[model samples]
Structures are given as C-alpha cells and as structure tokens.
Target: MKKRFGLLLALIAALVMLVVPVGNTTHAQAADNSLEKIQKKGVLVMGTSPDYPPYEFQATVNGKSTVVGMDVQIGKKVAKDLGVKLKIKSMSFDSLLVALQTGKIDMIISGMNPTPARRKNVAFTHTYYQGGYDIVINKTDKAKYKNKDSFSGGTLGAQTGTTQYNASKSQTKNTTVKGMTSQSDLILALQSHKLDGVAMEKPSAEAYVSNNKQLAAIPSDFNMSSSATSSAIAFRKGSTSLVNKVNKTVDQIKKENLVKKDYLPAAGKYLKTNTVNTSMTHYWKAFLTGIEYTLIITVCSVFFGFIIGILLALARMAKGNFFKNLLRWIATAYVEFIRGTPMMVQVMFVYFGLGLFVNLPALTSGIIAISLNSGAYVAEYIRGGINSVNIGQTEAARSLGMSNGETMRYVVLPQALKNIWPSLGNEFITLIKDSSIVSIIGVTELIYQSNIVRSDTYRGVAPIVVIMVLYFILTFTASRILNYFERKMQHD
Candidate 1:
C-alpha cells in the first residue's frame, strides 16, 4: 500500500510539473510582442457574443448575415487603427475571456465589464462604453413592479456569469434569481410569465422592450461601481502594449461620443430590418449552414472516434507483460477521466487549453474534443463486445497457426464488431444530438445558428421548434441508415 501510494503521488507531481510550465510560458510570451504579432498576422480577431442586441448581435447586410452592433463597430475601429483587418468571431458571452487568454482571439469587445475579478486573468483597455443595468418585465406588470425591489416573491432571470447576475443574487432580498446562458432565453421566460423580470444592460433591455411591445424596462436600482457598468476590450494577460494601443481608439470614441451619435443609430437600423421579417422561412440559409456544419462535425468525429476506440480498446485489454500492463492502466485511466467529466468542459479545454501550444479553428477544436470524448465511450463498448466473444474462438484461431495479432485482426475483431453493431449505431446517433454542445465555443453548428436566429428575429420559440424538427429529421435518417447496414451484416 505504501509503495502504491508513493507511486500515485509521483505521478500526480509529474502531471503538475508538466502543467505549470505551459502557463508560465504562455504568460511570458503574452507579456511582449502582443502588438507586433497582430501586425505581422495582418488580422485582428475580435471575439464577441452576438446575442446581445445593440451591443453586438447578428444582422443582415447585403442579404448576407453577419455580426453587427456598437461593440462590433468599436472592434472595427480598433482593428483599423492597428492597420490590421478585423475578423469577428461570435461565441457565447461566457467564453470570450477564455478565448482571449488562450489566443483564440486577439481581443474581446462583447459588452463585457472590467470588474476587478476579471482584471486578474486578462488585460483590459480603457472603457469604451459606459452603460447601466435595467430590469425588463412584462408590460402588463409595469405598474406592479417599479424596480428590482419590486420582485420580492417572484423570480428574476439574467444571463449567467454577468455582473447583473452576480448582483441579482447578492443584492436582492427574498428574490429568486434564475440564470440562463442567453439573453433571448431570459426574455422568452419573461414573456411566458415564468420570470417576473430579466436583468440586463440598459441598452439590451431597451432594445428588447422596443422590439417586443409586451416588455417594458425599469431601473435595476442595484448599487454598482463604475467598473461593473463599464465595457472594455480584453486581451491575454500581460498584453500591455496591445491594450495601451487600443486604449487610443477607445479614448477617441469616448471623446467623439461616437457610441451615442454613430454606432447606436446604425445598430438600430439593423434591429428594424431584423424585426421586419421574423418568419422562420426567411432564415432558411442560416439553418442550412447550420445543418452543413453539424453534419461535418458528427461524421468526422464518428470516423476518427471509431479509430481511436479500437486502439484504446486493444490497449485496455493488453496483458502478459509489464509494458502491456502499463498500457492497460493508462487506457483505463483515460477512459475513466473522460467519462467522468462533462463534454462541455472537454470542448472548452481542447479549444482553450490546447490553444496555448497551437492555434486551432473553432470547428477543428470541436471535432477533436467530441471525437476524443466519443472514443472513450466507444472503447468501453468495444471492450464489452470483445469480452462477449467465446474463448474457444481465440483457441481455434491459434491452433490454426494464427498469431495473436492475426487472431484479433482476421477472426476475433470481425465477429466482435458484428456483436456490437447495434451499440455502435446508437453511439453514432447519440453523437448527432451530442454535437450541439460544441456550439458553446462558436462552431456555428445547428444550436449556434438557432441562437443567432433567436437573437435576430426576437422570436424565441419559433426558431427553437424549427431546430427541434430539424434535429429529429437528422437523427431519424441516421437511424434508418444504420438499421440498413445492420440488416446487411446480419444477412452476411
């Protein structure tokens, strides 16, 4: 027991040593050449959550859907000043900071606040937009609720991981605070009367109320410091050179009052156009793009995941030597670790954690993460299938002068796969649905496109129902194909 414990401690210490240096190296690199690198690349990538209207949201320009709003305008200005072309990457609001820190983006301008807590992890520029908070309630309850204080016994909703969310939980009395990932979801809840109010930035609240006549906004009345209400661009930690350069543009915007006179009015026009056609059919292109990406991710992940599963399943079943035992132990540990954690965290880790070493596009990262996750589960199924094979089959192959590898390759594996075909088919179908988790990192899959539709049209349920039917169509078609293959195999 003592020897085993010591060995475990040594393994843990080795992992820690491996992890610590990567962080230090990333920080050291970020401390310098931040501006030179962007100029050399000739493109400044700005990451933002495009679900927040008038701050940053999707809009149609020249009949092409794209990310727009005041924050995007600010990003364009910063990129122009740096003499680099601007590339906007739309993701969830909660992922912007991680994407910046991991170098997935050069900077973040997603209506994000520069609170002291966030400052510890990433560098922030001077404030570009100073905004306040508001609580949006159903217009019918506009008279009953005056402010945040009015929701004493009712539930309030806010986007998870925002300043307003934290404040709603900490500052309110006897009020139940509900957190959702998107502002559209919160507003949908309010419209359904599930929530008494939804707290958000003043501009967003106003936009929602104006677009949806059933909603009205009131002051949140929560005490806040300037840092909590102010928006700034964030870069990787120690990117002082880049932050200082971008501060010049932020200062110019504030001095010229461009946010009020220019950006807001421009974004409002898009909002008007967006509301003009809220019908689902108007956004078929968006959903089609979504289906294309979703299919790509699922198919790629399934093919690679099957290959990985075979290797891992073989490694887990290895025996007869010290090296084989070690391989088996490592494979078992990997399978357990993956199965224990959530797929969402794995997606983020692959995109952001591996990003420190090499830059990967969001689609590539999603495929890699989902493939790895699916491989672990598939390995277990393969292992069970192997176990179900009769020992006499292996003996029969060996007696016929077959080597161990030949036995597995020509005899055992083929039969084992036939036995496990149904399970593998189920895994493939499950992956079709599970692929939606990748949208958190902005892969532009079905769920992500649906979110853009929700934000664009301001009609939540229609987009959701459309995606629901689309997903069912995908899964149902996949199931029929799998069944046809199964029948063919059984006949053979």
Candidate 2:
C-alpha cells in the first residue's frame, strides 16, 4: 500500500506539474503500509552497503555478480516468504536509514545496529545476529595496543554512523575516532598507516587479518562497547507490519544457526576467490554497466562544468577594477580551493556533509561536486584561451566602431574558443577519469562497479587490471575523438 500510494502520488504529481507551479509539490505520505506495497509490486527492494563481507557484500556467484551474504540470505528469505522477488540496491551504510524513510528502498538489510537514535527514525527487526566488536591493528603495534587505555591519544577508525564509532568514543580514552562510510575504506586507511587501529565487528576484523598478513586483531579483548549492539534489519519508522515480517525471517535464521552455516561459508568463498577465468565470463554486465555510468557522469559533469567555466571566464574579463577584481578573486579562490583539495574530500562533503543543509539524490550530489570542481579548473583554461587571442584582434574590433562587449562577443571570444577547443576537450577527458572519485559516495561508476566485482568475485588484481584497461579505452578513445575535432577545426 505504501508503494502503490507512492506510485499513484507520483502519477498525480506528474499531472499536477502541468497545472500547478513547481514551487508547491504534492508530498507522498510514508507509513506502515510497506507490507502491502511489496506484495503489490512483487519485489522487495532491499538496500545495503556492499563493502561489508559476510553480511550483504557483493560477489559474483555462478557467473553473475550480485550482493551475497548472511544478511542478504535473511532478506531473501523474507522476500520469498512474502511471495516477492528480491531487488538489492547498494549504497553507503549511513544513507540506508534515509533511503528506507524516503521509500527509495522498502527495507535495509545491511548489518545495521539498532541504536536508540536510529530506532527513533526507523523500526528494526529482532536481532538477526549478535557479534562483538574487536580492534584491528598493525601486527607491529599489537603489543602497543593490548588494552583500551593503550589506545588513548591514538587514532582509531570505525564506520561513520555505526555503533562502533559511538563505542570507540566511550570505550577508549582520549582516542581520536576516524569514521568512514565503508569497512573496506577503513581497512584501506589502516593499511595506509593513517589509522592506528579500527574498531569493527570481530568477523570483519578477522577476515581482514586473514587476508592481509600485516594486520592483527588485538589479543586482549578491548570492548567495542556493548553486547547490546546487536545487528538488525531496518525499515521506515512505523513500519510495524514490515518489521514483523522481517522478524519472522530473522527467527528462522537464528534457529538454523545461519551465522555459522551460511555466513562463514560465504566469507570463506569471498576470501578464496582471486581471479576471473573462462567460467566467470558471464559476469561481464557488472563491468559493462560500470563503464556506462562512468561515461555518463563524465559527459554530463563536463557539460555542466563548461557552462560554469564560461561564466567565470566572462567575470575574469569584466570591466572596471572593482567588478573585475571581485569576480577575479572569487573565481581564483574557487579554482585554488578546488585544485588544492582532494576530489575524494569534495565528493564526501557534497554527498554526506551537504545533506545537513539540503536534501539531494546521491547521484545529483556527486555530479554537482564533479561539476563544481571541474568548473574551477575549466575556468582557468578558458581564461588562458581568451588571453591567447592576440591583443591586435581586440584593437581591430574596437577600431571598427564595435563596443568592448561587441568586440569580445564577435571576434575575440570566438577566436579564443577556437584556440582553446583542444584544451577544453582535454579537460572533459580529465573530468571523465576523475569522476571515479564520486564512487566513494556510492555513485557506482566504473571504479565502484569494479569494486562490486572485486567484492563479489574476490578477484583483486584481475579487477584492477580490467578497470585500468577499461579506463584506458575510454580516455584513449576520447583523446582520439578530440584529435579528430582539432584536425577538423584546422581544415575549417
């Protein structure tokens, strides 16, 4: 009923758009009717963050890449019992609650802990699995971090918005907690020497340690806060019927000891798989789709950046010292800031941090970050393009009785564009490749797609090699097209 009503409301809104102003939009009410909605749609839309192994991580099974884990199995059981097909949507774990609340997903099957604050926003099924947290550290520092007190004034990591993050705060003294969106990212950070230790589930820490030889779980048990930090499936607040349906499935899983029987096997399979063979060729869709999204983000963001670049270029060339100086300062400051910061930081800020001020779709936020970041650099290229135009051309236009604006509009600007076409084209190519940064926020572009493949297939170097080849094809093809355009311009 929730989704049926939502669909009906969407149709009504579409029709209303023809008559009503865009300012006043019809809002769909989200309620406890999710059970009815899934029944009607015949598909249970489950949201998860795919970076966590053994609990809804991505894996290619029988030549098809998809999310697979103990949590996923539980979700599947629920959907099957409900007589519906299961549809999995991957996103950041922190975004799952909002995704459920907004009806973007019918339920969240990620390994989400039912904290009191989270419970207020969404209903949780009964504890599906209970796992205590453990601290993972470099083997060299294992002796250094034997107890909680040893971590005082040391850097620790956890998944942002998770119980582990909160636990890291209360359980350890004077520890600086670094929170990331995904367990994979946290593990990577730990490997890079940026974090002294990370507080996460024992299973995941164990998995990392088993896979990465340099890492070790602390021998002495440092509490990850509470045994009460039990994992549960999440649904929108007031989704009582849905909650009950999920709980029923969880009861079955617990009765079966599915954690040991199912989750361990899955994690073992992921840990063991290392490369693609003739048998795995059917999973090509994951790679193909990844390339598709990368191209789309690259193309769209570059076009958006081009528009921004033009405006900034005009501002740089504006009349009067005050106006010119102000615009120049603003444009210069924007360019420098964007150039100075890592694209990953910009992506995280726009996708995660910017949400406090406004609501935006994940993809939209990513594109906006890419566009804004690209715009700054593109503006400098455009300014250089304009500057390359001979001063004699501007003077000649002025001598012909044309105004300063008219001279730039007719002669100077057009010639400037001709000179800068290749440079601008190069910018577009760069933006395409750099757009992969947005995947950190779960945009699912090429790199993110490959990540899913890696997650699912447990093939690390193979996926990286494949990604490199795919990116080269994209960038190389793009450079060729740009060269063609540049040559065509010369002939014209």
Q: Which one is best on lDDT?
A: 1
TM-score on alpha carbons, each prediction? 0.94, 0.70
Per-residue lDDT tens digits of candidate 2, residues 1-492?
000112222333243335433332222223356688779989888988877776767765665666777777777788898999998877766556545644567888777777665666567888877776678888998768885567888898887766667667777778898876667667667877889988777777777677666889874254543424477877866667777877887898889898788767866675555333423354578878888888888888998998998888778667677868898778777778888987766765565445534666668888999998888888888889889999999898899999988998899878888898988888988887898877755777888877776565444456667889889998999999999988987888
The most accurate candidate by TM-score is 1
lDDT of 1 by residue, 1-492 (tens): 000012222333344335446667567765688888999999999998888989989987787789999999998899999999999988877677666655778888888888887777778899888889999999999899998888999999988878888889889989999988789899888888899999999989889989999889999998989888888888988777888898899899999999999999999999999999889999999999999999999999999999999999999999989999999999999999999988987887777777767788889999999999999999999999999999999999999999999999998899999999999999999999999999988988899999999999999799999999999999999999999999998999
| C-alpha-based local distance difference test score of model 2 | 0.73
Model 1, residue 210: what's the lDDT?
91
Model 2, position 312: C-alpha lDDT score: 80
Worst 10 residues of 1 by lDDT: 1-10
